[model samples]
Target: MMMRSKKIKLLSLAILSIGLSQNALAEDHWKLFLKNAYIDRDFDNDAVKDTGSWSQAISLFYDSKFQDTPIDQLQIGLDANVQYAVRLSNDKHAADSVLPFDAQSQKQASDYAKFGGAVKLKYKENVLKVGEIWSDSPVANIDASRQLVGTYLGGTLSSTVNDHLSLELGVLSKYSARNDDQFRKLSYTQNGNKIQSDGMSYIDLKYRVNDQLKAAYSFAHLENIFNKHYVGLEHNYALNADTQLNSKVRYFNVQDTGSIAAIDSQNIGVIETVKYKNHTVAAGVQKIVGDAFPALDGYIPELYFVNWNVTGFFKKNEQTYHFIYGYNFKDYVPGLNALVKYSYGEKIKLADGIENNESELNLIGAYNFQHDYLKGMGLQYLFAKYDTKYGNDFDENRFFVTYTKKF
Candidate 1:
């Protein structure tokens, strides 16, 4: 306990010293962004009833950079986020616990309303950063598709080489989960047991061959737990002025390590889409072989594109087919758009010959105000239905309104 307290004190002092020391030499650099959201979620025919209330949330992001010696090569900065959320006054469960900017209001959630920040240092194209920040990568990422996103605490070194290749090396120690206010160790779960990970690291590489083609490979490892490797290719082809095709193929390999080895698995996916005028149609297929998807704790919304509304259906021996249709009505009604999707999965054969099958249908519509005063204001609605032979069938509805301003 004493050591922990000392470490905390040291960290606080370091933050203060860096902030104050650079304040004198750092030049003018600061930014502020504000976003507000009102969200309502209702679930039908589930173990949990409809949450009695809605949620209103406001979030702010502020960052500043201080340069040394009037040059851009060496610099320091601090960034922080503040999130506030409250249940709807009318919600019967208005006093129910809260969650992060993540999903499912009726479920277990947390309060992300507190303050957190990180300090960053940059030199040229290489950046050495240490702090807590939002993630959007395939692994150790924050899924902000919902209202509150989680954050990561660690340090990383990233560099762009020769304008075509990018590289990153990082170590992550903790993650603030979307449904919990407390930051926890980066760990994985097996059976029903939580295995505390010693530490986690990643090596990510991406290369761009040309404007229309690119490939990437990333590897993440947790001591004595497991390792995840990914390889991907993306291409875009323009058929003409009004038509185009986009395609992607990706693969993941998960393997066990050290003492508590669980499962080893491989997964592959392919997707293709055609865009014509204001309409887009897409088809995709995914297959999982070997073992079930080796999902890490706190990891939600499958890191892969196979993820759907309810689940990715990424069980052992699971195969899924996906289809989607979307339209942009910008020309018809300015910033209006709509999308519908369906995903079907089968062949999740169990050892007893029981095949668990599932399917999902989702619909979404949104309108963004483009006028001057309400330019950044938007309204969105989403509905999803999940049907499964694996049980747990239910439907969900979500309504959201949002406004954001940057200064």
Candidate 2:
């Protein structure tokens, strides 16, 4: 049975790291922190006929703490992570190719790579975690846009019951949709060699109703026959001091519970099949300048709403809209940045048949160099255009350079 569930998740992470090192040796207060990151990407598409590929990644993180703990009343911790990826080009396009395939003319070098680890146990507002993490739910996150590293084994619980509420719950296993291995269920096939059943489950909520409003909600249950729901709302105001007025709205719903007869026989010969309810809506607005903007500092930068692999651009009843404006040059170039964005969406078919609509435009420019010979260097440029009524129209361009250091 999956090797006794991997020896009971490695004996429960070695008994939670020996009970957090015996509670930091009976309260001598210990702490540790380490982080590392690296990434690379390249892609292109002319309606997928080949000419796109490149990937690389490395990551590591570990955190530990035990600040005076007896049975919880303040601090206690353990967080761990380890990740790796290498697939530097081998070109074999078209397996749902949205561009990027040619890893050395199909001889496929690198041959995919992955390893994962996770452990979390905290006590000052509860937290208990387990192996193979990384599923920032909103319908499956952790797709750092390629370079592999997608994980999920199971067990998660987070809590914060005061000062504006928070809660999260999870259960996972059966995820290998391209990498970050570990699967004994959750099936999806198409060249990773067809296998099925990865029933998913999730619950999340966040609320903070002061200091400019906030809200979030979610529920998921895929593989017990798909049922998903999410709702979000955010608002911030300060239309002065360099302008600020952020707003956000989101909603999504999906349903189907005929108990999977092969997902009702592949939606019955798909022509964009419908009969299992779907609805999605998104809203966005961003404008900021000076004194801030490191990817807009923390929320709502609208690259299709906080990357759950580019958050659904209209695909339920279908509707989407986004707009962005940015400029930061306090002294002409301290971390130079500029941006322009526009998006439009449409896709409707309430029990009919064919008709797909989509429109998009994006342009971005970035530069962040704190000159010490390029401190944590980063430079980027991107352009995108897509138009569709039924077919034929595409344009995408991207170039990025990134570097980091931490030890």
Local accuracy by lDDT, each model: 0.71, 0.49
Model 1: per-residue lDDT, tens digit, 265-332? Answer: 88899999999999999999998988887776765456655444545678889999999999999888
In order of appearance, the predictions have TM-scores of: 0.85, 0.28
The weakest ten consecutive residues by lDDT in model 1 span 94-103
Task: For each candidate in turn, give its C-alpha RMSD to the true structure in angstroms.
Answer: 5.8, 23.8
Candidate 1 residue spans exceeding 4 A from truth: 1-53, 69-72, 89-112, 351-353
Model 2 collision count: 14
Q: What is candidate 2's TM-score against the reference?
A: 0.28
**Taking the tens digit of each residue's C-alpha lDDT, what string does model 2 give over 1-407?**
46435644654564466446555456332222111222222233354553344545444444555445666465545555433333455544432222223445643333333444555667778876777667676655654443344455777888998899898888776554343344456543322344344657788888999988888887867664556566677777655554455556655445545543222111000001111111112334222111111111011112324211122343334444455455556366777666565666555332356646666676667787898986776776666666666555556665556565533
Candidate 2 ranges beyond 4 A from true positions: 1-51, 54-109, 122-125, 128-142, 150-157, 162-164, 167-205, 208-283, 295-407
